[model samples]
Structures are given as structure tokens and as C-alpha cells.
Target: MDLIEELMQEITLNNFDVGSSTWVDVTYINNPHSFYVRPTSYRSFLKSMQAHGQKLEQQDLQLSMNIVYYSKTLKNFCRGLIYHVDTAKKNCTCDIYAIDYGCVEKSVSLKNMYSPLLEQGLPPLATHCQLANCEPKNGLWKDKEIDAMKCYIGTEKAKLIVKGKTCLKLIVELFNSCPDDIATMLALTGYSTLGYNENVFSRIPNFKQEKHYYTYPKIEPGNVLHVRTQSGKDLDNFYVAKVDEYYDYINNVNNLLAYSKQAQSLRPEDMKENKAISVFVPQFLRYERGIIQKITVSEEKALVQLVD
Candidate 1:
């Protein structure tokens, strides 16, 4: 099948149905935490309020339930799109049924509310298993930096859970292809045809070598393979390149490493003088085809060696 077809199929299978116009009044909310809402679930809740002989407005009734689903699109550039039911809204923020629901919808809309406490419940199936099995502590931010990012990006626990599951799935799927290495596989995922080049993985330096490495003897069905650096450093600098391109990149990095070593040996006197030498560094030393360009360095010390 074509790429579009494949994407459509994936969306059809994984995406949820908030319901149709006939059965549900759906509206999109701006808050990343609660992106969409369906009015159908409110039917029963609305009846309960009326049955109690409480002369509350329909908008008021909707506000009382405050059932809004959080949206996940706003967290990060590559974060997944997710939605969660937010009970605090007491009304759909989209004001979808303004005529039918009235001012109560406006009052209880998510826009007017502060971030609510995520309802404690079992996360969706797609998220629960992956999150439970995550390497770092469950529900804990990977680091203080990540926690700070969450706060700055206005991410809530619900959105984070959604984004985490999405990333995990992407990781799992890319690993399934077994495209020679992580860089090649990542290129296919469109993360970057180029492999990682910077200290992007500084937050989880050992993540690539230890956790993300794809060095399994055999990739069993239902099992994933990962590629990690030998030194347990971050893999964020690695870029995803096509398989064929990665082969060339591998050779280039090897050649550069040899040249770097030769240059260092020749300049032992310069090294003793504490002066940086202008060595002929290949622009594509670490080229991984479309995966990564090169690891550019002006420093005399070479910390990374490109693996063949």
C-alpha cells in the first residue's frame, strides 16, 4: 500500500470515535489537556439533575459534570495527539451546543477553568501497559529538566501519559523493521534522515546504549530491538539515515576517526603547548546518509569515535 493508505489505516485502527453528529455533539477545545468533548455522555448526567427537581439550567447541568477531554497536541513538537475526559470543566469548552446548553456551557467551559486534577483511573489500554513497563519510575518525570519542561509547556499528567504512549509506539514500530541499525530505522520514521549529532540525549545519556540499543541476538515477535552506544551516552546526537546511506556514513566516520587520531599524534607538540591544531576534519565524518550529517567539533579533545 501507499504511504497515505498506510497512515490512513493506522489512524483508522488506533484513533477513537467520539461519535457522529447524530449521536454526539462533538467540539474541539483549545486546551492541550482537554481537546475534544462529546455531549452524549452528558445525557444521563443531565437527567439525574432534572430528576432531583433541581431547577438548574441545562448549561448549569453540563457544567456540573464538567466532563472535558484533555488534548495532547500542544505539549511538544513531536508529542502525540491525545484526549482525556476532564471532569473539572463541568461543560464542554467548545461551546458546541451554545443554543441548546446556554450560558452554563460558557461558565463551565474549560477555557475559564484552571488545570484540574486528573481523575485517577486506569489509563487507556494503549498507555497503561507501556507506561507501567517504562524504564524510569512510573508517573515520575525522567528528570527535573523534564519536569520543568512539563510545567513550561503546560503539560499535565494526562497529556504526558498520552504523549509517552505515542512515543513508545513509534519506537516499537521502528524497531520492528530491523533496518540494520537504529539510525536507519529512525530515518524511516521521518525523525530525521540524519542521525543524532548533538547532545540532545543529555537528559538520558545512557538511554541509547543501555535501553534503546538494538543488540538482541534475535528479534522475537512481540519483542523490540534497540541500539545503544557502548559508553552509555545519549543517542540524541544520532540521526536516522536510510540503510544504504548509513553504510557509507559508517565508513566515513571510521575514516574520520583514523584521521583524527593521526592528526593528534602528529601534533603532540601542539598538544603540549595547549594550542588547538587545525586538522582536516571531514565534513561528513559521521555521515549516516540521510540520518545524520556530521559531528562538528572545534575542540582538540575528541570525545566520540564513530563506530564502523
Candidate 2:
């Protein structure tokens, strides 16, 4: 595959989502229950943004790719930098400006912007925004091809490690399934690619910065996984274990956590910091909005008690 480009100008009006919690980071200090910017006002706003960063001499505003109404109760106007606009989709990704990371996009973005161009046999120039809202959602050829490449490389690597040898079986349950944890499990002994998560597996290149990944799919439940130990251990002289054993252990641990006040945390690191979790695993803390119990299994259930 071609080299990665850190940031691609692909966010367009089509991709621009309106709402503080959804897409755009621009939020009104006052949550106006109702807000509406007339389409005409939106049209004008776009024109004014088109030539924003050009220069004082270049008197044109880059059409705004995004907009967020601060308040519906009062009309307040504030201007911000023109990051990108997508006219066809009638959306903008202005929320990126709020990112403290210097408004920089990543290398994988180029693939999103130019995949169609590559398909159309056109030279790729993703330095600027993809023509906004003009084309229908199309295939990401470059990105797909890259994933295909990774699959091939990963499968081959997995095969090489399991060749004629299965000693100590290791099954890891992630306490926190973030990118870091996903990557960590993938780097297990004897085989770095012996792990998979549906979400993190898709963005392997973005996270691991690698061209390939592999997983042992046939190593299913009830299957014994064996591995070699330290010195003096023969090739097959190792420990054997089943995948269900790991799950059962995790379930028991989760059960123990529920009753333990100190169990009220997620990751090992966070567990250390959480006085409650340090005391017990499944323990809960009494709060006004509902109790914040230990996130026994996954990160998604961490703070779900707070709901409006």
C-alpha cells in the first residue's frame, strides 16, 4: 500500500453533523432549548467562510462546511476559522477546530479523501476538502485494499506461530477495551497478532501503525492452547487450558466485584486510584444521580447511571 498521509482534507458539509454532543464541538454556554438558522442565513454563512484563510487581498470566504447554532432564544453571532465545508452534504466539520491537537488530521484521512479518486483513475489531491456534498457515498477503494493486505499478512503470521506446536494456552480478557488494551492483547507471547476485537480490529492501521494483523480464529472455545515456559521446558512440555476457563474466571471476578465497594472501577490502573475499587470490586458509591458502581466488565457501562 502507499504511504500514509497524516491529515486529509476530506471532512465536508455532507459529513458535518449539527449538535454539540453529536459531531460539532462548538457548544453554546446556554443550552437554548430551540435553535434554528434560516437556510438563507446558512447559505450566506457558507459564502462568507469560503475565502476565510486566503488573505486580506483575496476577498472571498470559503463556503462554510459546518455551523452550530449557539442559542435558539437569542441571536448571537461569532466567527471562527474555516476548517472545511461540504456543500453537497450541506454539512461542515468545524468541530475539529475545538480539538486541542492543533486542528491536525491524521495520515489515514488521505485514504478517505482519495479512495474514490484512485478508483476514477484521477491523480489524488486530498490537501483540500473533497468537493462537498457533490457525490453520493462511494467506495473507499484504497482503504479496503489496505485492509485486505493486512488480512493476508496477519493470517500468514498466525499460521507460522501455530505451526506444529501449541503449548501453553493463554486467554486474556480485557478490563478496558480501548485501543491500548486491544493492542496489548495482540502482542501476546510467541504471537503478537493472536487477538481480535470487532471495533479495534477494523482500524488496525490507524492504531497499531502497521500494515497487517492476524488472529487465530479456529482456536475456539473448549480448545486447549499450549505454550512453552521458561528454561528446561520441552517444546510440548507446557500448561494446557480451555478458553471457557478464562471466561468463567472473568465472570466470577465480575461477581466478586459487584459486592466489593473497592471493586467500583475499571482498569487495573484506575482500580489502584479508586479508593472504593481498592476496597472492593463490584462496590457502588452513593451519589445524587444514581450510584456509580464499579465498571465490572466493560468501559461502556462505566458511568451509565447518569441519564436524563
How many backbone clashes does every candidate have?
43, 38
Q: What is residue 89's positional error in candidate 2, in angstroms?
A: 17
Against the hidden true structure, what lDDT does model 2 obtain? 0.22
Q: Candidate 1 lDDT, tens digit per residue, 1-308?
A: 74334433442343221121112221222211112222333333322221222222334433113232222322111101111223455554332111112111212234432321322111111211111112212323334423322233231112112111121121111111243332333234432233222212222434343231223134468864333122333666543323333322321232232223323243322232222222433542222111112233432443333332
**What is the per-residue lDDT of model 2 for residues 179-287, given as tens digits with 9 covering 90 to 100?**
3332233333212333234221122444544222123246757865632121235656543324334322221222232123222334544422122322322232221
TM-score of each: 0.17, 0.13
Q: Candidate 2, after superposition: displacement of residue 126 in Å?
A: 22
Each prediction's Cα lDDT score? Answer: 0.26, 0.22
Candidate 1 whole-model C-alpha lDDT, 0 to 1: 0.26
- Could you tell me how far off, in angstroms, the CA of residue 158 lies in candidate 2 after the best superposition? 28
Model 2: how far residue 94 lies from native, Å? 10
Weakest ten-residue segment in model 1 by summed lDDT: 75-84
